[model samples]
Target: MSDFAIGLCGIGAMFVLMILRMPVGMAMLAVGYFGTVILNGTRSANALLLTETFSSASNYSLTVIPLFVLMGNIASAAGFSSRLYEAAFAWVGWLRGGLASASIVGCAAFSAVSGSSVATAVTIGRVALPEMKRFGYSDALSTGAVAAGGTLGFLIPPSTGFVIYAILTEESIGQLFMAGILPGLLLTAFFMGAIAFVTLRNPGAGPRGEFVPFEERFKALLRAMPLLLVIVVSIGGIYLGIFTPVEAAGVGAGMVALMAGISGNMNREQAVKAVSDTVRTTAMLYLIIIGASVLNPFLALTELPATLGETMTAAGFGPYGLLFLIVLAYLALGMFMDGLAMLVVTIPIFFPIVTAAGFDPIWFGVIAVIVIEMGMITPPVGLNVFVVKSVAEDVSMGTIFRGVLPFWFAMAACLLVIVVFPQIALLIPQAMFR
Candidate 1:
């Protein structure tokens, strides 16, 4: 068979493995290794696997993954995340659908520290959902907000998605992080607007929460200051050139650890649990990165990415038209695939097409992340939806999916606005790096 045909078969096999409930990292690794063996003998395949494994494991920039994960895990175990959610609730809980809106706000704030959609959803949803239910909010609206808001973890600064994209595309992590800020905030606003629309259409769905006195709100905000401060120093220091992303992550992790220790909120047991969780999560990410590293060369050898690029360019759809189609394709894939797996698999194929069409790489990173974020809440395989379901065990999957539907449109609108005004994704990075 032709090399391109082999590549197509390898991809089909990867999907088949995923359907059989195999881990994404292992599926990619297995496909890449065997595909290479088919094309170039066992020696080259073994060498490729070993070299890529070491290269990915030793990548200096990737240290940020473990450090950031530690920071978030420590914060969660220490109750800092709950404090952050409390502050958001105190400030926004009085509005119509206020509890739900507060959940979005909390998700955005926690996302700055966590950088994982599942983490964000679990951290905020655990606290927000019970309160929303107590206040007579519908499960769909309550669950939907948390799931949608959790996606901000992939878009905000310290995002794992941007970090992986940067590694994959050789783009600057700081620049991509900067690019994400405005778009992340923009999507958060759109999500809130979605809540308002839902609550307006059916007042019974979301009731207004109690008015938190100004003094109490101030106190709640004060309690949340530790995390807010860490977020600013870590993410803000990067933009101001005071720290590289790696240094920022290390510093942030140290600060959170100190706070947790001093406050006595993280006991020895909790500390061990936090570190164990960090290691586990970091290992999984490393495996996926290693798998991608192996798969990329195999795909390159196949010349499939190049062939597809040529075919698409020859189709006469200008850059914008091609972009529209790519977005649609991502949306379709999002329905059934894991977001990170989709990202790793598709970037090798699509990045060249996007950059070749004259789109800025950093801007495109932001755009790709937003589309992937949308997938986190998309149906069937909506990862965030599943995370929310795990938290709200009594709530049906259908109810959660129904809840996330409006937010899905909110995501679409956010994507549209960024597409039309590329500046939304580019402005910060340009201003900072200029």
Candidate 2:
């Protein structure tokens, strides 16, 4: 009878649909749409649907999604990801536990261009896993590194999840992007350190190697010049006020396309595949946005966020405690849900509470993304695990699970770092916006 009752029941039904193996977006769209219609009657729902669809489809901020995705797809197809790995591997592959550390660095570089966990895991796994196996790396370290490293795709720039967060919260997309850079690099470092420690403790997981010849390493590094150049220009341009976020996205896509075309890597077939993938991914994102549109009215009507915020604030939790709870909830839900779908459903509810708790929107956006990274490696439905699983077929599921455990801990450490010193997350935005 009440709004909360309908909402809770609708969410419950959504879980049932998920258990039945319905697509997440479709289930949410169906449940949220039908629930809105029930709560507001058919007439209001239909009218709002028409209005919301038109406006949401044409929204300027929403356009950032397709551009970022296009940039990622083009960069990937152009062979930029491989170049990044080559450089990272040549330099780091000689260290103690070198190959595994190289994979983390490679994944971080690839994540700079491709924004999805699936793409990151698959791309790097295709390139790095075989090499790690060849180098006598343990399946645990090899598979685990790729899986955990793939989660970086969401943390690095051009991140689709970060873009979606901006759209949902109506935060500045530019600020959201700048917020990701430091944290992304820090997490990558954490993964590398964890790999080194594991290898050092038990050299069986990895093998130390002679340094790569400076000449060969430099040559290999040269192979990544295009990728490095593009990343530097795109992210730097955005940060320095030289380009808006949307414009920066466009430039990145164009650069990727040019590089792919010049290098003869992107044939007509590859181009088609890239476009098709981009279109499909873009459509799915927009549909989720539309589904949120259907629920937006209900969000307003419920007043649930206000009540919940008051409830939390009154229970003697400060901003930090409330933040801890929100992050924890994200971690738990991530176990079974897709990251994007989880964001779509939960953000509408908790984002308000987060803002009420006196956090900056830009800072909170970074924190939310870091939390999602933990999900991508968590068991059951961790998308990164699936990516590696699909690529490294000989690896059992347990190996991949064990592999990600350290990275998960590293992700937790990254979170703690961000929580303790908000400046790590806030500095870039403050320096830019101020």
Candidate 3:
């Protein structure tokens, strides 16, 4: 069989393994390894595997993953995440659908630290869901809000999505992080607007929160300052060029660890648990990266990306048409695939096509992350929805799915705005890097 045909078969086998409950990393690795052995010799495949594994594991930039993850794990263990939610609630919970809106704001804030959608959803959802429930908010609206809001974790600074995208495309992590800031804030606002629209349509779905006194609100903000400061310093330092992404992550992690120790909010056991979790999460991410590293060269050997790019160009689609197709494909894949897995798998195929069409790579990263965020809340396989369901066990999956629909539209709207005015994603990065 032709090498391109073998590559297609390899992809199909990877999906089959994934369907059979094999881990995504292992699936990619197995497929890539065997595919390479078929196209090259066993010696070459073994060498590729060993070299990529070490290189990916030892990648200096990737240290940012573990450090930022440790920062988030420490924040959660120390109750800093809860404080962030409280601050958001105190300020915004008095509005219509205020609790839900606060959840969105909290997700955005924690996302700067956590960088994982699942972590953001769990941290904020655990805090916000119960309060929304107590306030007599509809389960659909409450659960949906948290699930959809959690997607911000993938778009905000310190985003794992951007980090992986940077590694895959060889783009600057700092530039991508800066590109995400404005788009992330824009999406957060759009989510809040969604909550308003929902509450307006069904007053009972989200009752107005009792007014918080200004003093109390200020105090809540003060309590949340530790995390806010970490976020500002780490993410802000990147924009100011005072720290590379790696240094920013280290500083953020150290600051959080110091605060946790001094504040006595994280006990020894909690600290240990935080470290363990960070290691586990980091390992999983590293494995995925290694798998991608192996698979990318195999794909290149098969000439799949080049062939796909040529086919796309020959199809006579304009730049926007190609982009629209890519977006639609992402949306469809989002229904069934994990966001990160989808990112790793599709980027090799899509990135070349996107860049070749004269689209800005940084802007496309923002757009890609946003679409992946949409998938987090998309039904059937909505990973964020499942995370929310785990938190709100009393709420049905269908109700949560229903809840995310409005926010899903909000996401689509955000995507549209960014596409029309690419500057929304590019402006901050351009200004900072210029």
Instruction: Indicate whether candidate 2 or candidate 3 has the larger lDDT.
Output: 3
Candidate 3 Cα errors over 4 Å, as ranges = none
TM-score of 3: 0.99
The lDDT per prediction is 0.94, 0.84, 0.94
For model 2, residues 276-357, the per-residue Cα lDDT tens digits are 9999999988887887776656656666556667788898878889988888899999999888888878888888888887
Q: Candidate 3's residue-wise lDDT over 178-266, tens digit each?
A: 99999999999999999999999999999988899999999999999988999999999999999999999999999999999899998
Q: Please, what are the lDDT tens digits per residue for candidate 1 over residues 253-370?
A: 9999999989999899999999999999999999899989999999999999999999999999999988998999899999999889999999999999999999999988988999
Lowest-scoring 10 consecutive residues by lDDT in candidate 3?
18-27
| Candidate 1 off by > 4 Å | none
Count clashing pairs, candidate 1: 0
